[model samples]
Target chain A: MKNSFSAMARREAAAGYLLVAPAILLFLLIGLFTVLFSIGLSFYHLGQGSLITSAKFAGLDNFQNFLFGRDLNLSRAFKQALVNNLWVLLSTLVVIPIALAIAVMLQRISKGIRLYRTVFLLPMVTSSVAIYYVWQGIYEPEGTLNKLLAAIGLDSLIAVNGWLGELHTALPALIVTVIWGSVPGMMILYFAGLQTVDPHLYEAAEMDGAGAWQKIYRITWPILRPITVICLIMGMNGALQIFDPVWIMTKGGPANATEVVNVLVYQQAFVNGDMGVANAMGWSIFVLTFVLSLISLRILRDKSE
Target chain B: MRGKHKWSPVWMLVLTMAVILTACGGNNGDSSTGSSDVKLTMWHWKVAFDPGFKAVADAFKAKTGITVVTQAFTPDDAYRQKLTGAASAGDMPDLYAYWAGPLEGAFDGKALEMGPELEKDAEWKNGFLPSALQGVTVSQANLDTWAADEKSSDWKKERKVGQIYGVPLDVGAFYTIYGNAKLLKEAGLEAKAPATIEDWIDTMNKVKEKSDVPGLVFSAKTFTLYENWFMNFVDYMKNGEESFTNFMNHDEKLSDPNHIHAIKIIEDLAKSGNILPGSVSLDIDPADQAFAQGKATYDIGGTFTYASLVAMGMNPDDIISFRVPAYADSKVPDAKVTPFPLVQMVVTQGGKHQKEALEFVKYLTSEEGQILYANGAFDLPAVKINDTSKLNGSLQAMAGSLSSESNWWSENSAISGKIGQPEWQTFHADMQKVILGNMTAAEAAEDFDKAAAAEKAKAQK
Candidate 1:
């Protein structure tokens, strides 16, 4: 009876493998294969047109070219890109905490809570590019921001060139836009986390003579820590990959003030026609993003412990 | 645990593969249509040329039993991406418009060498403006040599060079100071045609001092018309025709004391308060519109932007263009800022319909054909056509300056093709700093010179 049962189980396993084979094959051929191929192309010197006909075995030269200054001035461009990315990453750290605070505030409101939640979540659903362009219009020389400043007798604060045009303000202006767009999704995440939190703990803290701030510190944070970690991870990932605001607003102009690594990779691939270096840059970016994300996760884990 | 089974769905992986495949799907090709008759396909980004191309196809069909199919894609980069992919697959449209630069050079034997045939026919050759032919002209060196491997001995031959890649579509000065004819008249500036740099400055300053409207304006945000044309003016000020030839030969940097002088000239113009207040922030369209709506008196523009001015409801007669005049302390006294090659049409070697394709190109560049094309497209012709009576104000301005304006760097200049624009962008960034009062002219020159030298080294590599 045992032997017969084992034989039947083996047959079922074979059937299952057969059923999933097509999906596995498709993924290997198109999705994972493309990524693997791109990684391989990073080591080859693929010049401008007709990639197959023109490429040569370049080894680590492409990677070296991007990171170190070879014959080309790509290193400077990359440096600018890294600087901008740091700005985004640092800005997102601040943004996630603010989002959490807002979510906590929303939790306290009893009447018309749904309306406030809906209003807060509106930015998450709106198109990012549309929001960016709207911000652009507001940042123009004769745009709404300047007009408002002028009306308030704070006209001296308006940038000589528009906000997006000036080197000093372009990245800061972009950071504001990204934070504005990102806050809502994070609010929703915290809100969901807040619901899952055990209400008994907060009541227990209250009975122990815990104040509102003390209750939040003792009960609210410890329970919602996982959500905070998730938000930080996603926030950091999103910030590092910022392209649209800079592309639409400045084109990395006014002297490469707002150029991020992603934009650099794109320009190298498309504009500069150096796909080999572009791929190398892409791999580096992926590695950097992974390491940073892992570090964040580790730190959060340690802090909780 | 004698037997176990675990099979969760790879749903995310499947979905990702599907998206990637969708994005990598092939472009919809314009395959040959007519049966029996000799069939051909032509591609371009000039959608305006559709009517003219159709008429020419009809005419060609009447003359010989052949069918010509044409397609146009726009916003340029999309068209280029498509062409690049097509070239990789060894599928090229029989005839297509391409820019004359390193991109064209990359397709070595892919394109048919029309130069030998073009040179053999004198009547055909003379009909073309020398500058037009020179615009698309480059060295005969095969691009297989330029492949990253860098092996060329098999096809290499000494003492033979200068190949014309394709026939130019049109040519003229790329950058000009276009006056609002009405505004200039109203401002009472005696600057109908600027004879010198001082005269141009005086005219702009007069408009600044007298006119109720804004003064000199140009798009300075991107390293495009403003920086490029400024460099052209500077280069002209720096190099004579021979010295510029030497500059193209990679002997001279386009930055020096003379170039710094050029920067200061523009800086002085800005300091004069003759420039529009927020000109540094505006894009090309808004800058052109500002001048057109009587917001500014004089604006710098190219062939394309000049058309935008007219399109924005500015009268044709109200728009007048003049060359960037030679400055007082210049070596190239007769220098005028000239146009780079715009676009070229080539017949690829692998296409089955080569004869028919060449015939179409020949017809399209002929006097009659050029006239029809000019009328259809609202631009000048590559060939020296007799009539300019039908051309618009912008084209007329472009055509009128053709005789005096010299194309400073021919397309043959490997320096310009390899790293000119990239290096120029760095220079432009410094130029911006100089203009914004962040950097001095001397400091800008030093930084710009370093960048240019690095680029020149890259190009040599």
Candidate 2:
């Protein structure tokens, strides 16, 4: 009976691996393989042919040219895009704390609160293209923003050819759109995290003569740490891969004021047909995002424990 | 603990290996597995030209019993991206069409050159105009590996230099300056083409002053418009073609005083408020809309712009095509327009059905196939048009220029595509600065020169 039971346990374990095998293989094939392949490709100069025929080895050169080329052409472009990407991330991060506060406020209010939350989440459901176009209309020269400025007799504030076209405002305009689009969903995460928090903590803080600000500082923030970290990770990844709104609206134009890293990498891979440079860019972006992710984790470390 | 324990650190190493293994396995696609099949696949970016292709495809199928599958990718950029990826994958269609430049050049040696057979067949050889045929022909330089002294044996084993890899599908012009007669009439000025740069400016300023309209309008947001404009102005300088040729040969600096001065003319016009306000942000469609709404007297456009303007509700008679006016102190006595090929078809050697694909190309280039294309798409097929009276006004206008005007060479495209000219992009960027008062034209020119030198150095390495 003991021998039979051991055999059955082995069989069950084998079956478990069998079930997970396809998932592992597919993940390796599609996700992991592509990442590793890009890293290998980054070391060579490949275009116009497959790897067996065309690619020539030049290890670390592609990376060097893009990051620290003499002309400051590719490097400058990469740096500029990094700045733009960081702007998107930082601007989006600013919204999370504000969103958490809003979620907390909504949680305390018990009457018809679902309706407010639903309205707030409406933009999250709408397509990004549609939302961007709406924003584009708002920011156009004759658009609502300019009209509002004109109405308020502050006509000088109106940007020439709309805000998206101006170098000074193009990235900032995109950041605003991204933050608005991201807030509702992030707010929901915070709101859900708020629910999981023990209500007694807030009550205890109140009993200890804690004001609203003190309750948030002492009780609310501590519990929401994990959720904030998750949001930051997500926001960083999203910012790094931002392509849609910029492409749809700017095409990285008005002198490339909105040329982010992803767009440049895309241009290299497809438009310029320089896959090596593109792969180098991909790895560089990965390193950046990985560093950012690590920083987020460090920020969210359980310091008290 | 259970989750963390299950995901061992060793699994990370396994995953990394999986990535490398997968990439190595997935990347090297089946190379040139041209199977014996009567089915022909053709790829193009013109969805509007579907009926034209279908008519030709149907005729070919009826004649040869070969099935032709056609796929169309719109917005051209998507089409190029697919073609580029497919080339790496060895999955390019049996036959594909592209504008003759970096795109068609990408498949230069990979394509079956039709030089010998095409030269022997008088009917096929004589069907296309010289310029039309020239657009699709692959020059020696375009075949980067092909040396001037290379023997026929060295030339793809069966082909030599000066061979044509593609045949033209249609012809069109770029950078056609459209004069709005309606707007000009409103300004109480005669609607006609100006002969000199001063005259053009005078006419534009008169319209701007006399009417509530800008003198000119363009989708200046993109680099293509500026690049084309820059070329036109450069063509007006002393030894215009020689200068252009020298520039293409990489001997002439992009920041030459003459080139910078030429660009300055356009910059000055914009700085003087001749171009529409916020023109830098306006795309082609919006600029066309503004012109159609009578907001501008002159707009830079292409062959399709006429149809677009008409479609936008302008009368055919009100629209007229003229080459951009030239500099008075220029070497060229008369400025002429240049009409280039719109599309060309080529059969890839990478695929199996080469003979069948060639037959279809032959059919498409035949008189009947050409007629079907012209009638259906309202486009001028590459064939010699004995009678263009029945053609649409826009097409007829383009065809009329074919006899008198020069044909723009594919040289610049080849050179620029090959060299990765960073200076052109820099020049394009600096024009914005020039107009915005951030830099003078001279400063932009100096930067352009520096950028060119930098690019040259980079390329040499």
Candidate 3:
């Protein structure tokens, strides 16, 4: 192997390594090291504001507190947060079809396709904090949603406490915001995939006496399956790690109705200063997310095949 | 071509390395120009107080020939992160301000013990009110609570009482309420303090009936505000010191009818329909802004709320302020609000300019410094000043409200430490449920007792 490279080749390889050295060093120090450190920290009982070197090893105690019922309140909060995360994940069912429908509609239109795409992608590119605030205003007790409901003679349907302020509506309101932010990238993916399908294939389907729905189902659906998988994976990850929306809008208020795992992790780590338990809960979320992603991937791949 | 490529790669590597090295290089030159000259760095999270702090620092520099550099960090949680990060890097400033609360336990061993120094200057020590001193001073109760903590290290367990780690710049009473004078007059109500909770409720209802705006508003979205800040005052007022102390110490359960009634009084206020709509979602600043904007007639906040209300363009003369009204026909009917230290200034344990930093701390807490800070920042001072007329517009009113005779719970004290965080969080959420009319106050009280019991049981284990 050494003999295979001439002096010039060896020198070129050295230069390449040297060129990438700083980046590799940074990744190791900032990214990979912190992750490994958090994993190690999950098993300890570290007091607040103490140095990491002073952390006391507590074995599985940290995990047991939040995962099992060693600390009942913590365990209950974690369970509630997990359930909220599932609700967020389940929202993708509504999100995917709407996004796919928009992609299909955008494809049929001949004019202003780029303008439509850019408009659809605005939420994805916008600052999430600013968007959360806008949604917060919309979800206020006298906000646009309630006012619209009132105007439509559905005044009985308005939430008096605001959408983000009630137990029944907070989670759903957050899910709506999540879906609104999530759909654009997914729609763009479907749109790009739709662009690849030959127009002649659709023409052939039309000549075969297929209706619009049938053509969409037979020709368009199968081609978009891979993109659907990607969307599902991304959506699942995003929902599980959802923080900014919940933090800004609700802060998991009105008695933990909208509490999600990441928000709980933040409370435990920064607010409560229970770093060990926070890290344990974080790892637990990672494991759950990994398993869920893997299952979804396998099922989707099997269907695709 | 091969020869050119070889040297090009070599030269490029050298250039990149030089740039990287230059960027990462530390300044090896000495920062201190003179051996006798002293410069101290202080950090705080108060953005409004930054200019005042700079002015005070300038005064200190002129008087003592010591340079005090003040920096402001905003939005408390981020400031905590900054302090912790700087601590980890061993690059924390000479002095920094921190909130005096259960959270202060984090800085236990990290802050320099100022008890001996404070003792040396009896005047400075006595200048701050006894209530203001409670936050910085570690009482036996504090030591006992720390000892009982499962995570307590040897230093914490061995710590004694009378250990002062910091000095407060100002004292705050969280149970203070402010009324919009224009709205009050419009409602045909007198612009005076309500003597009882019932009177306050009646006044709010009158305001609601007569005016377009709602009568009452607060940061109800802050889950801790109702239970921790407001209800504690109600409990102390209704049940008196004995019952409040027992409940705080976890010896008495919140499920008792006495505590339940306190919760019921707050629930009644909510049930009156005079609370601003969407208040359950409004945060602290927005609620104050609501009162300032004449969207609401009344607001519940602390001494800190005045500056923000004024900043929002509310006229100081048009504002009527008072403590949270006492419960009528209850124990301690004459109960008044007590002011406890809101923020503490401390010397870092490993600071380079310890002596100068201590001198600055003394100056900052001095009578002259308090007047300078209070007037400049539009804030209340910790020290008792004889000439209240010298203070700024609304601060004089706030300073007058601080009485030496009033007794109240201090969140920064050990009493708060005894209530476990999990229990406080549980009670906070459940109390919100009660206020929302989703659950009865009795039911919430029962839940709170259970949560406290569970916490105690876990602590025992």
- Per-model DockQ: 0.22, 0.15, 0.33
- After TM-score superposition, the amount by which residue B36's alpha carbon in candidate 2 deviates from its true location, in angstroms, is 15
Local accuracy of candidate 3 as per-residue lDDT tens digits, B167-253: 888888777789999888877889999988889888888888787577788887786676555677677778877788888866788
Q: TM-score of predicted model 2?
A: 0.88
Error of 2 at A122 (Å): 1.8
lDDT of each: 0.72, 0.73, 0.80
Query: Which DockQ value does candidate 3 get?
Result: 0.33
Model 3 misses residue B271 by how many Å?
2.9
Model 1 is docked with a DockQ of: 0.22
Candidate 2 residue-wise lDDT, B1-461, digit = tens: 67766866799889999989755643121322322237889999888788889878776666555678998997767787777668657888999987763225344366667676688788987887766666566555555522321211133333444677778788766647888898888789888888776898888888878875778888877766756643543453445666766665557765675555546766778767787766667788888888888778888887767778988998888886777666677776454444556788888875787877887788788777787777677677777766776555667667777542334443333442323345567677677666555577888877777777776666565
Q: Which candidate is the best by lDDT?
A: 3
lDDT of 1 by residue, B203-306 (tens): 77777778656567788775656655555544545555555544544466545443456467656766677667666667788888888888778888776667
Q: How many steric overlaps are in each model, in order?
A: 0, 3, 0
Q: Which residue pairs overlap in candidate 3's backbone? A: none
- The TM-scores, one per candidate, come to 0.86, 0.88, 0.89
The sequence of per-residue lDDT tens digits that candidate 3 reaches over residues A1-305 is 66666877989999999999999999999999999999999998766656555567889999999888889888888999999999999998888998999998999998998899889999999999999999999998878899999999998889888888877898899899999999998999998999999999989999999999999788887888889999999999998988999999999876888999999999888887778999999999999899999988888884546
Candidate 3 residue A284 C-alpha distance from true site, Å = 1.1
User: What residue pairs clash in candidate 2, if any at all?
Assistant: A32-B19, A33-B19, B34-B352
